[model samples]
Target chain A: MARFKLTIEYDGRPYVGWQRQDNGPTVQAVLEDAFAEFAHGEEITVFGSGRTDAGVHAKGQVAHVDLARPMTSDALQAALNHFLKVRETGISILKIEEVDAEFNARFSAKGRHYLYRIINRRGPLSFDRGLAWHVIRPLDAEAMNEAGQRLIGTHDFTTFRHVECQAKSPVKTLDYLRIERHGEEIHMLAGARSFLHHQIRSMIGTLELVGCGKWTADDVTAALEARDRAALGLNAPPDGLYFLRVDY
Target chain B: MARFKLTIEYDGRPYVGWQRQDNGPTVQAVLEDAFAEFAHGEEITVFGSGRTDAGVHAKGQVAHVDLARPMTSDALQAALNHFLKVRETGISILKIEEVDAEFNARFSAKGRHYLYRIINRRGPLSFDRGLAWHVIRPLDAEAMNEAGQRLIGTHDFTTFRHVECQAKSPVKTLDYLRIERHGEEIHMLAGARSFLHHQIRSMIGTLELVGCGKWTADDVTAALEARDRAALGLNAPPDGLYFLRVDY
Candidate 1:
């Protein structure tokens, strides 16, 4: 058996998140099926670094899959992409390379990077309608950044964690959270060793209140200290979130 | 009558073109209908700076319209946008301002700026399928820029002009033609007072040959000097082209 690591990109609009579920198509099921086609109907299981909710895009999502048949990494990548294109799937295999069997896409992950886009304009979105979060009121990105800074460092993120999160503990080290304005859009970049379910989106939704002068930075700190899910302000939608990449 | 100038943005994938047609829906027709709804059935003509072909997007397309009834620019913009949203059109009114009665969207424009996007990668497109042109082979941006420079200044552009172009003269000055690589994508910015129909796409398609080392700068010069439509190398698809903005 040969194990290969694959870097994938997807629009995430047509799937039921990254995981395979019977409800609808998913990124994982799509990749596995594409691999099975070239593997001559050999059942293939592909493991991902993490799961992203439905409507969340990915510029670079890493995964690992083991194949019973041997083939050049380049050939396999090309073949998989060919099947994906033919199937009209939104997923694309960016790169593929051989990896040690010991490498686990889920367990060996070091860091995760995510980007959330917000279109801060009064006008409704046209070109970026489904690709970004649209906020009608004017936003103070500087205020949002200041509030985001309060969430840095190791802490109990229970306030931002989803109630249905499967993680046992809410304590996680947040490496960085930086927010900046790019013309009409607000981009927030967050990095961490790991995140609880809906943690990033929860934080962003609370910070948006600060951006619009509704909540102060002290409010964000208070919410974190509460360590209660009910203390959270709001949960940002999945449309604007993107799993940028995983760092090992 | 009050004249209003509109800065518009649109995802042109659904429209027939900028101009109104009997064949199908168009950007012009959508705007006209929206205005008519709010104008109490008064006939309103929205004149665009230039007509963009089908499947060509616009980030900053400019237009002008005359209203028989007096209304604040802001209110008019808001009403039109509300109607557009209700109709689910992929067009947005970025900005609206009252202009001089003499202002003309087409004749008064001093220059037009356009952008062409080329995704230079081996993978098939996903998120940017219709938003960009996918090129499998490697491209040399420097060579494309070098060849583009030769097209600048006043010259007879018959070679690049479309056979169906209705321009009275084939002579037009190209203000600038710049090629730059942005990550995995190649962006080409072209500026001119006016362009013959299909001139920009024709130039980009030919420059692509130079970018892939299939043609030299001298070859581009020869094509331009030939001043014949038969000498043109290629006419790029309308998918990657964007009507960026118009200067008054």
Candidate 2:
């Protein structure tokens, strides 16, 4: 069997999550159905880099699946796009690359990038209604950045992890975390080797408190050291989170 | 009664053009409903600067509404936004100005800026799926610019005007028409004193032909001089069009 790496993009609004579930439609199920149409005999199992929660979008989400067909990557991409046209599901297969059987998309990834967008304005924008976090109050960008800087680098990150997290350990390297302002919009670009369950959301929640001047940079550090789920602030809404890129 | 000018932004996907229609919802209908809630005494009539076709978005559309209550422009803006939140129409009143009694939004002296976004790529984008025109083939940007220059000067654009256009005179000063490329996206920014029915779409259709190498710059001029609706090319999809700004 030959391995095919697929670069995928999806609007996560309609998805329960990336993984296949009986509850509703998913990015995985759509691709699996499309793969079945192209893969003549064997059932194909597509593997994603990570599980993105419902309503979280992706621009460069990576995945891979093993197929029995001898088709080239280009041929497979064309066929999959044609099949996906049926639902207009807003999920796209950007590129397909033939890889060695040993290659795994998730395991081979060196890092991942995520972006959280916030629209700080009095009136919510229609175009950005669901695509961004609408925070009416003005945020202190410097304060938010200072607090986010505290979360960067290696840490246990237990304070920011979800209670139902499946990771064996909370220790993870946060290579970057920065918050910047453009017009009335605040964008948070964070990157790391990998993340614990709900780490990014939880961190953003705590940082949001700092942005709102409710918490300080030292307060953020204390929350990290406390290693308690309740120590973190409110979990920021999922509307703003986007899986920007998965690096190799 | 006081006239309040509104610089508005809306997602035009749900509306049946900007005007009120019996068949479907409209931007006018949505705003009128909001105005009715804010101003309980009188029925409100909104006069838009231009009637945007259905599915054509606007980041800077202008409209005027008169109300019996004597409210400041700022309060009017706030109240309109507050009342608009009920329906979740995805429309925002960006700015409001108290205009003189004689000022008419539709009849005011002004020019308009429209932007047509073209995603020149093989695969579809998740976020902007219905927000842009996806042209898979590689387009010649230089050739498109060369052709666009032919439509920049004042001329009779009847060839590019819609047959159903109601304008008395077909002659309108075309201030500027430029086609520029940014990364994988092609943008066409056009400005004119006034537009004929489906003028922007007709111009885009002809320019698309130029970009695809099917028509020459001279051919565009010939089409403009023909003064026949059949001389124009295809009407580009409304999704890619946006009323970017209105200059008065």
Candidate 3:
């Protein structure tokens, strides 16, 4: 069987995360159903780079599927888009490529990139309602950036780990964390080989406290050293998080 | 009575239009209901710059309302937002200013600015669904711009005006019509003191034919000279239209 790497973009609303579940609809189930149609009634499984919670959007989410039929990547992409559109789901197969069998979508990734969007405006969002986290309070993006620097490098991220996280270790090295302002929106970008459950959201929540002038860089360092979930300042909602890209 | 000028924004997906109608819900109705609560059970009427057809979003729509009770702009804004939110409408009052009694939302406007967004790509939109007009064929933006310039200045826009338009005269001065591309989106900006119904959409639709090499600048000039609605090429959908701003 030949594996095909697929790039996808989806609006995370009306989804119960990326994984298949009995609770409600999911991105995985929708993709699998579309693949099944392309596979001529045969069931197909789609493995994703990572699982994203409900209301978490993705711009360059990656996945892989092995199909028994021999077809060009372009042919497969056209067929997949046709079936997915028939389902009327917001998921779109952006592009696809044939890859070696050893290229597992989940384990063969070098790094993952995420971006969190925040709009620091009091006006209710019209076009950007579900696309951004609106914070009425003016955030100090400079302060947030300074605090983000403290979270870089190796550290025990227990304070930022979700209690329900299934990861085996709390210690992970964050390659980089950057915060910048773009027009009315503030963006928080993070990079790492892998992350614990909700790690990015948890870190972003703590940095927000610093941005609002309630916390300092040293305070963030202390929180990281605390190595306890209770020391976490907050857990940002899933509304603005985006799986930006998965590096090869 | 004090006349208050209010800057507003709304996602037009749910509303019938900006005007009040018995057929269904409207932005004016929602704002009036919120204002009625703030006016202490008294009825309130809102005057908008113009009516935006269904599915036409607005980022900086302006309106005016007269209230019997005197209140600070801040208080009025806060109260209006509170009531609107409680009603769960997607409308937001961006800013409010106390205006002169003669300041009419519909008549006092000197000019209007509109932005039409077109996504020129083969891929189906995920985040931008219902927010843009997706054109599968590649467009020649420069050619479209050249044709747009032919429609600038004073002209009898009968071919471009809607058949059911209520305006008395077909002669209208179009100050500017410019087409520019930004990333994957091509934006058409139309500026005028006023326009006949469906003028902008009609003009853009014809220009699209020019962009796709089906028409030329000379063709647009001939259509303008024909001064007949039958001469029009197409009337683009309202999904891509945005009421960007009303200039005073």
Across residues A187-225, which tens digit of lDDT does each residue of candidate 3 receive?
999999999999988988888889888999999999999
Candidate 2 DockQ, CA atoms? 0.51
Residue B118 in model 1: shift from native, Å? 0.9
**Candidate topping TM-score:** 1
Model 1 has a clash total of: 0
lDDT of 2 by residue, B41-126 (tens): 46788999999998999988998877777878878788889988833787899889998988877788588999999988777666
Q: Point to the candidate with the largest DockQ.
A: 1
Candidate 3 — which residues are off by over 4 angstroms?
Answer: A72-75, A85-88, A153-155, A168-176, B86-88, B176-178
Once all C-alphas are superposed, what RMSD does model 3 give against the true structure?
A: 2.8
For candidate 3, list the clashing residue pairs, or say none: none
Clashes of each: 0, 0, 0
- What is candidate 2's TM-score against the reference? 0.90
In terms of lDDT, the poorest run of 10 residues in model 3 chain A is A122-131
List ranges where model 2 is wrong by over 4 Å.
A40-42, A86-88, B72-79, B82-88, B225-227
DockQ of 1: 0.57
lDDT of 1 by residue, B61-98 (tens): 99999888889988988999988882388899989999
CA lDDT of every candidate: 0.92, 0.86, 0.90
Which portions of model 1 miss their true places by more than 4 Å?
A: none
Query: Which lDDT tens digits does candidate 2 get at residues A1-248?
Result: 78889988888888888989999989899889888876654478999999888888887899998876588888888889888873378888888999888888789989999999988877657888767888987799878988899998999989899889999999999999999999878999999989998888888888889999898899999999998988988788888999988888
Lowest summed lDDT over 10 consecutive residues: which window, candidate 1 chain B?
A: B82-91
